[model samples]
Target: MSTEVISQIDVDRTRGDFHYPEQHTFDAGTGLSHATIDYISDVKNEPDWIREFRHKALDVFLSKPMPTNWASKDLENIVFENIRYYLANAQRPTRSWDEVPDDVKRTFERLGIPEQERKFLAGVEAQFDSEAVYSNMKKALGDEGVIFVGSTDGLRDHPEIFKKWFGRVIPTGDNKFSALNSAVFSGGSFIYVPPGVKVKHPLQAYFRINAENFGQFERTLIIADEGSEVMYMEGCTAPKFETATLHSAVVELVALKGAKIQYVTVQNWSANVFNLVTKRAVAHEEAEVKWIDCNIGSRLTMKYPGVILKGRKARGEVISIALANNGQHQDTGAKMIHAADETTSNVISKSISIGQGRATYRGQVHIPKHLKGCKNNTECDALLINSTSRTDTYPAITVRGLGNSVQHEASVSQVSAEQIFYMQQRGLTEAQAMSLSVNGFVNDLVREFPMEYSVELKRLIDLEMEGSVG
Candidate 1:
């Protein structure tokens, strides 16, 4: 491998797609078994209780079968036995960037993580492969009694808080992927906001998959105490590889009384990656929870960020944007469950399919018969770029109450030759016109994203449209 300087993350060949030589010191070889689970737990030096938890979760994972019914037949391709469960160069995360391995540090530097942390983020966690290379929280936040650290540290240092909320939002047995993540999870964020304290800036995490034939399972949990507020953002990327890669993560959020929590994710995976993720939140009395998700590249991705409105006057919202180009499938949506009277939930989803790619939206909203004064709204829109592109939507909503109400809407549209020609006539090239039109279709939703991610979305769209116009 060359140590030559790479200028930028491009689209077709090297779109944020480059890798360094592997120098791993810990690897739980290629297979899924009891030995693998024990190896992971022993390496982490976890307590006996946690080791038992992983074993039980492994049983659940083995009991459940692949989800080929709804996740497309592609689920059959994931050979769990061939995936290396754990790979890391260090036993624990370093608090200083200077302490990170040179290659790992360069990876973050190239992705602009350090600069972003200095500019806006209140804290940043950089995870490589299966472990965090660097984790740091702003001194100001620590002074305010806010706990921001990797999940491993959370369990070891703040057991009282970590044990109280971990897996409460999304249980290990909730699904097969969640169970898998529980059994072999590693580096992810764990945050606890003290009551009545609001973090002024966002906390961010960057997950990079730098190895081949590997599985990266990270678990994250966040709890916002009474009247507190927080916002978290995550970005993911992987280098293209000939072998398939797997990334399964479980994320849970808890917004206590009158608190607010916002979670955002932008996934730009390689085409050889299978991105299966499960994320959900719980909102208590007068609390609010929101999920902002963007999916750009993957061979197949299935994720639905849900919220359980468990208290009166609670609110939940999910706004998602997904793009599938060439050989990719973006299966994404939201779930909202109104368990209390006066609760409210809303969902807005938009997807774009280009080339032979496919995008699907799956939404579920439930307001039980006992719930009164609850309201739910859902809207899904999809765009098809070329004749070969594909999109699908499946929404299931159940409402039972006189005072409660629910509204639903869905639309699918394609970029007509007239629309592209209209732009091309204005001195823009064909590819440029197509890019503009695609961006226009989703500009409304893009505005909901923070400025930096919005710019990244546009750049990804432009790159995908290049040479795609026939």
Candidate 2:
């Protein structure tokens, strides 16, 4: 929603098309149980509190039921006992690229991470399977009291800062998947910017899933101290496996007084992957938190990035783009809770459904009677590319506060057959004509994406159209 643009997405369509042989030194065997919990805690040498926390979360996961809504029926297909909870090849992440294992380095090389790190990013972490193979930050940032590393390292090394806000924004009982992620979480990132420090370049992480019937649960936490600012971008990918793969991640962000945090996600999972994630942020007085998200490929995706405006004049925003292909369902949206006076929130979402795909936008905004001068604006737009494709929008906005105001707008349209035929008559193929039409439909939102990623998104949409229309 903000004009602060992120850098080019290093990984794209070809990023996870190939996978190397699996050679994990550590693998928590299939199934979930207390033994699995013990194994994970033992392997990480976690503190007793963390171990206890995991046990509590697992109990919550078991006690809770899968969502019963129509949008969640597909979730029943996931066999929890059949999924491997964790797998990793390394104990500690390497800071230098030369120190990284050849196989791990090769995996990152294919994603263009090294080049991107050198060109645009201030720091980078490349997570493979359940652990980070490489994690590094520029020295200038470290000198300026910035802490950037894997969540594991964050928990063990900087407990003072990490423990303060960890799991505070989004609790374990937020949902079943969240509880599940909290129980078996690994990798992801932890970033802390000291007061008044503004990171000049964005930090980035790439999560790659390389095993079949395996689940990757990465946990991320970011805290910007008073008057500080930071932007983080993450990309996820998994090879196309015949058996299903599960990716469930949890992200929590905290922005202190007058601070700012921008989070960007580019997800491109394979067709056999289920991408379910929970992300939320807390914005303190005069602080701001924004989520820039894009979803492309997955069998099913259910994610809603939310923010709680906890202090006066706080702001929250989300700008999202989701494209669903054949046999895929994209269920995505945002949530905003205004708890203080004069808070503001905005959401702009655009989605495209191709072939027999389905896309749904579900959002929520709440302002209690105690608040005053709170405002919210939400817009959801969808484009369908085929007769059988489908789209839906659900917005739940409650404005009970004195002088509070809310605005919501939603629209759905289909590709014009006449326009496609006319473009075809001008010598363009069906896919080309379809690409032009789809681009025309989403260009406004694409312009809001980062420069190179905007181009990459356009290309990805064209590729999807080719598969559906050609």
Candidate 3:
């Protein structure tokens, strides 16, 4: 395709409407204390053991100081006492949208989750504030040995499976945010596919932040048994508030022997949100795992989706795209660790910065010397819409063993006036021309998304580009 077409493809066609929810009252108030943690546990009616785990995690969260040397400096300004730890919109997940509280149902309806779920998804869960308001699974998927529900429901109904893998991939003490998520996390998806089963349609979850001064810490877990396959998608949005809100989440995935798993996230939180999330997966013998991550609209985002090749011949791939607007900073990347022989991994990352926004990529690819026949490929590209926008690339590679192959490439450039002029000459508006160029920049990665999602993503990007023109 021509450059014009390529760029146009990057621009979304959907004129995205900004729909903000009316704020509500939900508070546990003031810092990481025993009483606050207990209040959260009691609100959820969680079992004693799980509550104990939360208290332990809360201790860890308090003991660890914020790491100042990391991706962004915004962490230092976050006030722990200013965030509401929990809010329950519903006592339990519901199978019907009508069964959800009218207010919460209106929230998801405005966000398009219900319509999208009915048209294309196999399962859908909608979370309002810190709890899932509605969750439903198609009968076909239930008959085919697929389980999809909120993490809370999983803990109550599938205790054996949930207990075995809850903290296996990402322990509570793995990092400060992980600890925080473990302590107060709520309203995330839980998925499992029995061996040899395949979920043909995607399972989706939507997260909405409807309260002011609230923190949304959601923990998600997915397991694909041997020879099984599944794909999951997540969408996030929040009301625009003057004060910054916190959204720290942990997501873990396990792809067992001969299984495949794909996890995709399309984050469009309001610009007042701090999106600090930890996501990682383990690929066992001959297993495959992929992360398709898209980031946009957050005031600051520091996320890195990683994978571990634990068993021989496992494969991992990360495809990421980030779009940063004025007053926004997107610092995102990926990590790949090769622990066994014959493991292979790939990373493709793209970013776009407009107005005064800045985007950064920090990544790692590690292959221990003891591992043989391991290979990795990494590519990162950044596009700046103007001179004021900034982009940075940082990649660390450690190769220990012999016979390992690794390749890395990176490029950064501002949009070309010549290209814009050429596109305008072809009958497109300046904004449309810019949109087309941005779309083309990440066309390949957009193709990896489910058709419905790709279409929506493209439209969102286009709407973002509307007023971005000088």
Candidate number achieving the greatest TM-score relative to the actual structure: 1
Candidate 3: residue 221 Cα off by (Å): 0.5
Tens digit per residue, CA lDDT, model 3, 303-413 = 989999999999999999999999999999999999899999999999999999999998999999888999999999999999999999989999886899999999997
Q: Which runs of model 2 end up more than 4 angstroms from their true locations?
A: 1-13
Q: Candidate 1 vs candidate 3: which has greater lDDT?
A: 1
Query: Pairing residues by index, what is the TM-score of model 1?
Result: 0.97
Taking all chains together, each candidate's TM-score versus the true structure is 0.97, 0.96, 0.94
Model 3 misplaced stretches (Cα beyond 4 Å): 1-27
Give the number of colliding residue pairs in candidate 3. 13
lDDT of 1 by residue, 383-426 (tens): 99888999999998999879999999999999999988888889
* Root-mean-square deviation per candidate: 2.1, 5.5, 5.1
Q: Put the candidates in TM-score order, highest first.
A: 1, 2, 3
Write down the lDDT of every candidate, Cα atoms only: 0.91, 0.91, 0.88
Q: lDDT tens string, model 2, 135-189?
A: 9999999999999999999999999888888889889998999999989999999
